[model samples]
Target: MKLSSRRKAIAPATRPAAVKAGKCPICGKPQDAGYRPFCSKRCSDIDLGRWLGGRYAVPGEPVSTRTEEDDEE
Candidate 1:
């Protein structure tokens, strides 16, 4: 009985969780059917709040200034 309960609890957690365009990045909550992307209105609003709250950000890459033969050429 304990094993069954544990299995049930762990079943959903074991499912594939991804950061797709329409899926929630913070949690594995499915996109809402009405929200058309988020699993629910609350999740969708939360995502928006995070964005508005500046929780998400774009990462920058390091730039290379010198060429391999800069001195020679």
Candidate 2:
């Protein structure tokens, strides 16, 4: 292999590049690599709590609860 061709293959790996960091979706803060998408543990926990508490609900058809009368019928 030619030296030029070898350099071309290795050039990509040696380049110093700027990485664009993403903001947290929950808190509008710079995203942390540890938590990811959330700035801190608290924000991550808040997001989870929202999911568990049904605060973050998906748009869908409302489900009707079966009544005792409906069950008897």
Query: Which candidate number has the best TM-score?
Result: 2
Model 1 weakest lDDT span, ten residues long: 12-21
Which parts of model 2 have CA positions greater than 4 angstroms off? 1-20, 55-73
- For candidate 1, the TM-score is 0.37
Query: Ten-residue segment with the worst summed lDDT in candidate 2?
Result: 10-19
lDDT of 1 at 35: 76
**Which tens-of-lDDT digit does each residue in 1-73 have in candidate 2?**
5767766565455334322566777878898889987899989999898887685566577888978788883
- The pairs that clash in candidate 2 are none
What TM-score, over all chains together, does every model reach?
0.37, 0.46
lDDT of 1 by residue, 1-73 (tens): 3666765565454434354445655466666668756677777788788787675555456878878788684
Provide the lDDT at 25 for model 1: 52
* Local accuracy by lDDT, each model: 0.66, 0.76
Model 1 stretches astray by more than 4 angstroms: 1-22, 55-73
Total backbone clashes of model 2?
0
Clashing pairs in model 1, backbone N/Cα/C closer than 3 A: 30-39, 31-38, 31-39, 32-38, 32-39
How many clashes does each candidate structure show, in the order listed? 5, 0
